[model samples]
Target: MRYFEFILILEIGILLLLSLFGKKLLNRRIVSAFVLVTLVAHYFLEGIRWQMYPTYLMAFFILLFYNHDFLRKRKWYIKTILIFCLLLLAVSGAVAKLVPVFDLPDTTSRYAVGTSNFTLEDSKRSNRKLNMKFWFPTSKIGSPDGVYSENPVQTLDGLFDMPGFVFGHLNRVETETYNNAEILNDSIKFPLVVYSHGAASSHLDNTGLLREIAGEGYVVLALDHDFSFSDYNLKKSDAMTLEYVAQKAFITDLIDKVVPNQVQDIEFILGNLPNSNYNLVDHINFEKIALMGHSLGGTTATDASFNVQGIQAIVNMDGPLNTASIEQLELPFLYMSSFSPDISDKSLEEKGLPDAMLYRRVKQWELENVYRLHDRNTIGFHWVRFRNAGHMDFTDVPFMLPIMKTDSYDEHKGHLLKSSVILDFIDIHLKNGKNYQKVKDQSLEWIK
Candidate 1:
């Protein structure tokens, strides 16, 4: 929580305690004044959050009920209602304070991060509209603010039966990239990294990691399949690859059915990105392309490396590789999975499933990638799991929506590990990182 918010919650909590148990120390006039003052500060300075309405109402209730004489005159039901309201307030207030909006730590790279968006309709006969969300290194260090795109609560609302405003507050979570900041004019080019989101997720899911890597002079392009912005989340999985395979499909069906569509998404980006006239294109090194994705996006990245030419490496962030994509794709792949125990508990408590399905999916993806890495059939591959993180932990959703984030997973620790390791891998393959061995770990066991 931010400092002002912490103090506000703390003071309000103290006032509540004094009102309930410190009758001997209570001064009605002073208590009334204190409640009024706190409410004023909350609305004007601290910013009123939706979940804390109960807490705010509690202050108003205290003002109405603090006087014993006035309370004695109130109808029995009114007093009972006030009591019930306090209980409700206490519960919501606790949740509000507990699940505070978290700030992303500053990027460790030297370059400033900037983001820009462009729209294109592929002309490849099967042409489709695509939204390209790109984060690239800029000449300046912190030019301006950039939009983070999708809000987790708003994005997830249709998937669940919850009220919309319950997560409206998540929209307040922000990113540091200056929108379309001027690209650096250096003659040398930067490596390309294509990122894809999980099923029913947004390209904006991994902002912290994206910004960190982009700041280090990589051109990160995340493709937003229009389905992600539509009501498809309620109808199907975000990653089309996971939907059709459905336990009954043959590998032929998958190759002809789903993988082609994902590959099409990548091809369109690669097709338009170089000539789209965006300033960042000046720094694109097509020969150094690397693919990264979460969930089904990983499937797309894996497929692209196999089907498309010039993709140097791959990073699959906890995504399952469909039979079709894994069969033909064997590139330098990085398998980053979150096998944390906290993930299982949250999944069970929230979705009523054990999350064992995730483990199964991880094993499936790892086995394929490990085979390529160990056999030297591929360039290189690494499989590392975050023991304290869940599938959601791979992205920035947990950090923005703390309720979705668990206490056990240190978001920073997991992010740092992934960032340093992936950056090193990208550098070793796409740029220049002869020190890749320095990032070796005993804890992050590699299959090869």
Candidate 2:
């Protein structure tokens, strides 16, 4: 158990002790003060910033129940309410600890396929570098270990600390440790997938999902945008350097402006294969390329499909549309969101793009194939709402944070649901003939 878990258990014990000794503890201001202090400490240690409201309420009730003189004066109904509150606190604490938070499958293999860099002459002058890895299936029936970005620990530390801020405590894992060589040559010609990460996030964020796809006989290519969500190694001068700040600012500014230009970059990376350093030239079925991205990366994927020729399908995992490219889209596309379409509207508008625009644009694409999944209609565009999925549901980090209990984000469910849906769609349009009936019949939801 981690330090957090130990602390949680300790808190539960305290609550139990208070509940059992309420009569004796009544009128003891010092004990009440101790409880209050512990509660405050709990909040800080657990990082429960938003969850403090309910925690405070529970603590208040614990204090009220322990004051027996006041409880005796109250009516039976009031006493029952106090008992119920105590029960609620007990249940909440148990639920917090007992619930299996993030769902991640055991990873089986990892592979470092290739690496390359691109020079962005359009906006900020810099080299866009990428160290792409491919995780493949090694066995027919076995759970695989989860994959991470070339630098797992660093990525997590960066993600947890703040966007764009790199902390010294962050740890980075060896890329080879997450790379699987045995499965590199598993298939003669596998399906192709191009992945783009979120803003300030590296392509390594979705290693679990990427590896799962590769294991299913697909060559997944993940690229890092120059000056966007990537870390650059530079020599330092006396610890504090204007050059470092300038470099960081330059990258941040690049990501802000590059959203629109990413379409071209995607094409530049895909069309010019040799430039990408991927050696699956003989293994890739160029005609069956699929584009995918998360958050801001999702917008890139959507826009790139319009610019990148020969792409059969696209998947946008929670990325709102970029107004510039939405109207020009001309391929089969899938939009998977954690929240309902309603919540995504503001993000769409902020980007000067909205789902209404996407809907119309998709309609214009008229590829003779389109599908939607919502929270209401299971058979139509709306599928069942994944009860507890958060915005980070589409990525792999939620699965790796074992102590952070997230009941709604199930790795197996997410992996099976997302992979099965994407694979089925790609298989039908890119590899097999159109099978709208399968998607409509909800057959894609079932996964082995």
Candidate 3:
């Protein structure tokens, strides 16, 4: 909770206690003014959020009762009113705690971050328009309020199958990047990192990490795939349920189409980026381009490195290699995997679990796929496991909602470690940086 938010809640709680206990320790007029001033301060300082509406209304009612001398009646109704006000205060505090206005972590780089959005159309595929967003190093200096998205509530509502207002607080969240700012005009061109988002995720989902990469002097480009939340095509119940693998043939066919098409989209973007009017376009060094993605997009990146030429390296953030076409990867590959519980049939039986056969099959396939891919790539394969991470940890979801994180997950440190490792990996391969040993996190380890 923010400073003034906590203070307001505490003041309301104290006021309710004093009123309910028949204590006249403070002047009624003074109490009224105090609450009023606090309310105004909270509104102006923290901005108005819907979670505090009840608290505001209750404060007004309290001042009205005090000013009208209704509290002097000493009747049972007075106690009831005070109790109700206390309940409202609790509600306000709880909601405020649940939906906080979060701030993005600081970008650990010398360069300031700038971002811009653009769109591209693929004529070969019925002119399907792909939305793209890019982040790059900027010489501009200023900490302007950053936006999560122009309309994240609607997209997140559909993606999570929740009411739009559930994420309305996100509208107030701030990031660390400036929009449409001038890109850094250094004489040297920056290496480009092409990013692909996961299924049911948008291109800007990893904005916090992408901004850090850009701040570290790389141009990062990410795209919204056809399966992205804005254009989500798959039914969550059918594809995300425990019975997923039961429809293996159906889902596999869909992914087979999705991965290749997304790869084509990446290639198309890279091919046209040089001709584009973006300020970063002239400063991008296409010869040292790297491919990176999360979940299914990670698989797409790995697949694209083989099909596309002049790719320097690949970073697959917890993406299972279920649908990767080639068995061997010759390029520098970073496979970051999230922690998953072992779901063996014996363990399931011992734990009295239901027979979710399809779920078990899907997990088995993923484990095998990762092992096979890692084992086959004898050269330049780096694997790291994030101990307490969920699939969405690699993105900004954990930073947004407390419920999205595991009980043991350290959101701040986890992201910092992720950014550090990714930077180290890309720097070594793409920038040809020194190979000195660096500090490593115990939760994250090199598997190969």
Query: What Cα-based lDDT does every candidate model obtain?
Result: 0.66, 0.52, 0.76
lDDT: which is higher, 2 or 3? 3
lDDT of 1 by residue, 369-392 (tens): 445444654546577766556678
**Candidate 2 backbone clash number:** 19
The stretch of ten residues in a row with the least summed lDDT in candidate 1 is 231-240
lDDT of 2 by residue, 281-384 (tens): 56677778889898668878877776666788887776656544544665776666553333344543442222334433332332111222222223213122
| Winning candidate number (lDDT) | 3
Minimum summed lDDT over a 10-residue window in model 3 is located at 347-356
Q: Which segments of model 1 are wrong by more than 4 Å?
A: 3-46, 59-69, 72-79, 97-99, 123-128, 141-167, 228-259, 340-377, 403-408
Arrange candidates by lDDT, descending: 3, 1, 2
Give the C-alpha miss distance for residue 268 in model 2, angstroms: 2.5
Candidate achieving the largest TM-score? 3
Arranged by TM-score, best first = 3, 1, 2
